[model samples]
Target chain A: MQPTDLTPHAEPELIVFRDVSVHFPVFNASTRSFRKRVIQVATGGIVAPDHTGHIVVQALTNLNFGIRSGERVALFGHNGAGKTTLLGALSRIYAPTSGSAEISGAVGSLINISLGTDPESTGRENIFLRAAILGLGRDFIQKNLEEIIEFSELGDFIDLPVRTYSSGMQLRLAFAVSTMLRPEILVMDEWLSVGDKNFQSKAAARLDAMLRDTKILVLATHSRDLALRHCNRALWLEHGRIKLDGPVKDVAAAYFGK
Target chain B: MLENLKAAMADIARSRHYASLIHILGWQDMRHRYRRSFLGPFWLVASTAALVATICLILGPMFGLPPEQYVPYVAAGMIVWGLIVSMCTDSCQAFISQSTMIRQTAAPLFTYVARVAWRNTLLFAHNLVIFPVALWISGAHSNMNALLAVPGFLLVLANLAWIGLVLAILSARYRDLPKTIDSVIPVLMFMTPIMWKPEMMPLRIGVKILQFNPFYWMIDLVRVPMMGGIPPGKVWVGAAVVALVGWVVALILFARTRERIVYWL
Candidate 1:
């Protein structure tokens, strides 16, 4: 088959979610052990509330949205809200429980920001590992390895094991590697500030520059100021449902309105 | 659910992106594992040698074969057997071990499976050092038939990739599988003709055991040839069938349950 035509180029990535719901079946008593499951399976099939002992967590209930290119969307929700789930769906990490989540773009994720990094390795080695997990090709990482190193301003520390670096220094390295690749859709959990005051300004500038060309930016955050400054649109998720979806000013006003 | 499976299968097939990660991760894992050890992966050789020596000392007299002939036979059998057993045990850890990567990134499930395969393959390569030395010590000559072991070895690896992928998915969901496999493998090694010779057993009993054990065919493909003997035609046929049937089942299950893997993790 011809390479399945994905979303076309020269157009913004059209991220469309239609009535998507993600239900997680809580693996409970009946399914936890082998003998119990075997007995349940042998007698025809499992029978319980919503299919035998699975307490389904309705993580995203009929979540619907359309994210086009050039849209800066901020996700706001209290803890246990669906902001992360919605982002998870968008990233294709969590498939929809029902309906659909469709996107046409090479996604770049900073979720957990430094998730795959090995602290036992040198900063340079961690960069390689993290870049690989980020889905960056070795050739690209190789070509820009120096650029990422310099940008993080890690200097000699880059040669030292990341275990030795302070948390701030480690964050700086992760931020640099994450930003190095310019993805079509840029997804972040929150506005990030790392390092001492001197380096924080540099890190912020780098993030701003990274955001400049990104076709779509989805930031999930609790800070209204961060949302208003960086996002043009807003989504307020409450208990696995969208409470509001509209312009930043209106949604923010409505959400924060006592 | 079908769509989830389809998407999972498609993502698993999209190796254009994952291959690089698999290779780098595999090599890095191997390097990282032995970074502090001076002998590095060569320790694999040392351990295998020690195991073979210990087994030979105990079993050599009982079999009534000279140590020269018996040692090569046992060492090669153990080497090939160790690799197959390790693959069976390691396969389960393929996706489960990389839960952080799976949850944080959009990496395909097979990438982690490939990581386990590649790392073990490297260790298997290290374990291979004994075969040639075994031949020399046993006073065996290098013949054209010995070259057949090369293809036989490759066939084992091909079978390994599929086996690992299948177990990676199943073991990810079922917490008991790896432990079961861990216990079952030592029994499997005892069942297969590793330290003991098939000729030593009654024809009916040995045939019955060999018929049930696919490892016999796979290891024989390498084992017989390393000893300068040709592997029987039935062995090749068995390997081909296992590899083919194994792939068909593995791909279907991979397509169906690949999405659910993360939830299990």
Candidate 2:
């Protein structure tokens, strides 16, 4: 099927979450008995209660939005405002409790770039491991092994475990591996700010390259300028709901009230 | 559903080396465990050796078994049991242990489980060297048929995969699983035929009860090759069937629960 036909009504929206509401049960700590838990739930007690007086932290509440193909959408929100949660839903990290999230194409998320890197394993080995985790076949990693190593610029350190490398070195290696293959849907959550200034420009360039082929890009960041510069559309998530959705500049201005 | 299973099988076949990814991560775990210790990985071998010696000295005479035979038996059992125990316990905490990674990455959760299993498997391999050395030093008969233990070893690996899959998902969703496993494994060890032969049970009821323990079959399967005897067909069939069933159930649970693991954690 042609890509355009995937989401016929929406021009092949890459990611769509329809009226999603994720409610986790909160339970009382003192009553550890099953009967008590049952009673608590029956009486509107939280199934799993957090430390806050509120039984459950409504992480994301009735979130609804769609990103059309080839659109770079920025998710802007304060801490705990569900920007990360929404990004996670898109990445299939967190399935919505009450709604369905449909994606038209393959998604690659840089939520944690170095998810499987071993401190004791050489960079080359970690590249294989990380690539496999990202759903890349072993042969694919093998073919691009040299390219991945060169892009990270670890040179001789490619043989050393990542523990010895500086954090910048680690991020560069991770970023290089993650972006080596273009993904139809790319989700990033504040990973662009790798520590090194030199690597920052390199990372930005790599990200730009990825963006070029990327059909859908959903980036969640608090930086207004970053959102405006990189994204054409912006979504302001407040209290787990979409507070604003429009042009990047308009949403950023409304989100920051500037 | 069959197609999904076929796809998953193909996925596993394509990603078989993903199992080795655990070995690499296990190396890190071993390093982390011995980071500042002067002895490092050697300490694992040393400690296991000491435990085996102590157990042999105390229980060999108590059970009326020769130290020569008993020491190697206990040593091998300890290595295998340690591997299984650590795999179960560690996998329960798999998602929790990598909370930072779980929150930040979109990688499959199974990678963490594989890492734990592989780490324990390597340690099991390291501890395995002690058995041959102990047997040689103790003057026990080292039979060539010990090579037959390869099948038994493969069975244990299969069993471990099933256990890892189930516990990894369960422990991710339930915070209390690791603690529960920690408390129960020693109890399970006592219940199993690790240190003592199943025939040693004085009561018929006790023998029947021990027979019911799946671990008894596993230990007997492996011990047969090492002890230079053919394990009963029942033992092999029973162990294989249990492993297969357990594996299927675990995979189903893993596939169903995996999506919720992140939320639970």
Q: Report the number of the highest-DockQ candidate.
A: 1
Q: What is the TM-score, restricted to chain A, for candidate 2?
A: 0.84
Q: In candidate 2 chain B, where is summed lDDT lowest over 10 consecutive residues?
A: B7-16
Q: Write the per-residue lDDT of candidate 1 for residues B100-181, one digit (tens) a residue.
A: 7787788877788777877888888899898777767666555677789889998898898898998888877676778878
Candidate 2: tens digits of C-alpha lDDT, residues A1-258: 787665535566667778887655453444323344456779985554343233566888887777788688898888888877777778776777788878778788877787867777778888877876676777788888888888788999999878999988898888888887688988988747674777778778877888889888889888888887888898888888888898899998887888
Model 2, residue B24: C-alpha shift (Å): 2.7
Every candidate's DockQ is: 0.53, 0.35
True contacts kept of 1: 0.48
lDDT of each: 0.82, 0.77
For candidate 1 chain B, the 10 contiguous residues with the lowest summed lDDT are: B134-143
For model 2, the superposed segments whose C-alpha errors exceed 4 Å read A1-10, A24-54, A114-146, A153-166, A191-201, B1-20, B36-39
